[model samples]
Target: MSERNYRAAIIGTGAIAHAHARALQDAAGRVSLVAVADVDAGRAGEFAAGYGRARAYGSAEELLRAEELDFVHLCTPPRLHAPLAVTCLEAGVTALVEKPPTLSLAEFDTLIEAERRTGAYVATVLQHRFGPGAVRLRRLQEAGELGRTLLATCATQWYRDEAYYAVPWRGTWESEGGGPTMGHGIHQFDLLLSVLGPWSEITAVAGRQARSVETEDVSMALVTFENGALAAVVNSVVSPRQTSELRFDCERGTVEVEHLYGYTDDDWTVTPAPGHEDVQALWVKDRSEESSGHASWLAAVLDALDQGQAPPVTTADARRTMEFIAALYASAFTGERVRSGQITADSPFAQRMDGTGARWRNA
Candidate 1:
């Protein structure tokens, strides 16, 4: 809110925190990383040393009280997101949280309320939607170049071995939320929802077929968008050959992107109708060279700071994605179709997503 480099801090010194640091570093003149905090002071110190000017803290409370940060990145696990973000908002600082922003829709609503109470804002890390290809596709779809969407697919098929699940939070519903659906597949599906807009209905089935986790390791859903397009969504951790894919079958042609974690212009391909080779030209023109990643999204966040507005993946957008996660679980466990906005504050699925509750156990 001042005429200075926007002060920032990272709350967790974990795997994703490294990306946040690199992204902040890349935005050198636009922002500064003033502090780093973690349960392990050594890890925080190590992260601070890597960034030069950053101070290290043993806890987020220390970082918040000591530093006058404009924003903080909640890179901690899923469960800590709402608490950390609420803490930042209460301290008059904006927050940029990592994906699967909260454990459930109820927690997410708490965040929405916090942002309302505080003037500060919150943005979730959905880097895929910031890519040039995604931007181009959304523009193309809007301009009627893609024509009416008929069907689509969003698949996040990633391989996580037994050792990976050994992490206490990896497979648990309370810690990491849901498995591939909430943790891994969220990116592609968020991007899918971005392209398709509001979803009306979802019918899904989730199963703990392979993983020893308390939640579903694999799930599939049929989604009906408000635009009249239909989609088949799949989330899985058991696939040996991992890939992140989203394909849209539209009236003009098919737009597809295939990648693992992130996407570049190279990963996006447009298969236009027989006489529509020029469609690809229109799609590729005026495209940003950077791929879909934290750096790009961070730039957008910093830019929004200059403009005095909440960044992309705001609560409303994040809620749609989070609501879909709820709907996925609600439909998967319950043998009924779930509509948007069904998982309210009073619902058991909104409170906690494990299969031990009424709607879940009845399935």
Candidate 2:
């Protein structure tokens, strides 16, 4: 694999599909969006036509059966992630999939095994970690400028109307996973886990407070991290306005980051200890590339593939995040503390979500 163009396929022509297409086009020389797939042929055709050099397929199965792709990016609903990813891997293709890899831990484990057997590069789209602000915050924490981060939490308040959940398979426990927690909260939660390391336990409660969906619209969780740091997470689809932020209260200083998704000029506020002014100087060095989410992860994947190495965000990482969600759901339903690593293949929550009796708002 010299400097030859890296051919790619995109499975799912939904809203997020365009983001993948644009990023692939941006990596023109190194990567090319060679094909597009969707259950809706019209959608796939339209997507392919809009983005140059793409052939369209009616379904993911059709694409996998016909195309010889170097890599495939899956923008399907969360429920389809596991099967589609495993299909791609079995066909000897790597998958760059959207977050909350599957509906349950059992599915995640099966996919992990598929990756092991097939040696596929399965990576999730947790691109927020690529932002300069996040990188800088990580560096500062490493340097002890923000010493002993004891408590952390994230807030994501975004609105999604009935029309939003009207799409088939949008708000079911079987389809989109579990609404805000798996679909919306996943991005920021991944960022949180990235910065704070692994969590030790979680207790949560979720309910369908607003829109009509099969899953919960509002949820809250209390987490204990491996480092003994406490965290609270609140996510909802009921807010009129959107706000996404992460705050880390540390020993020496408190660092706050505010954004709906990515970096902004007023992205961060760092308060250092009495003599830690030098920490701010570290931001002066220029990074060669911009820190936008999707593009950065694509760049990393292409580079890693070129170097014959694994992707930065691997299936194992996806498992951890999935476990986090599982634990939260388990705690919420059982009224018991759930261990982070306990949501394995054998965990009861692995097969069915606890909200079996309850139906999503729209579903």
- State model 2's lDDT: 0.82
What shift in Å separates residue 208 of candidate 2 from its native position after superposition?
A: 1.7
Candidate 2 lDDT by residue in tens digits, 88-205: 9999999888877788778878888898899887888888877777777788778866778898889888889999888988888877777798889888888888889888989888
The digit string of per-residue lDDT tens for model 1 on 296-357 reads 89888877878888988899999989889888888877778999888877887887765344
- Each candidate's TM vs. the true structure? 0.96, 0.92
Best candidate (score: lDDT):
1
Off by over 4 Å in 1: 1-4, 355-363
Location of the lowest summed lDDT over 10 successive residues in candidate 2 = 354-363
Query: What lDDT score goes with residue 249 in model 1?
Result: 93
Each prediction's whole-model lDDT (CA): 0.88, 0.82
Among residues 3 or more apart in sequence or in different chains, the pairs in candidate 2 whose N, CA or C atoms overlap within 3 Å are 212-361, 212-362, 213-360, 213-361, 213-362, 214-360, 214-361, 215-360
TM-score of 1: 0.96
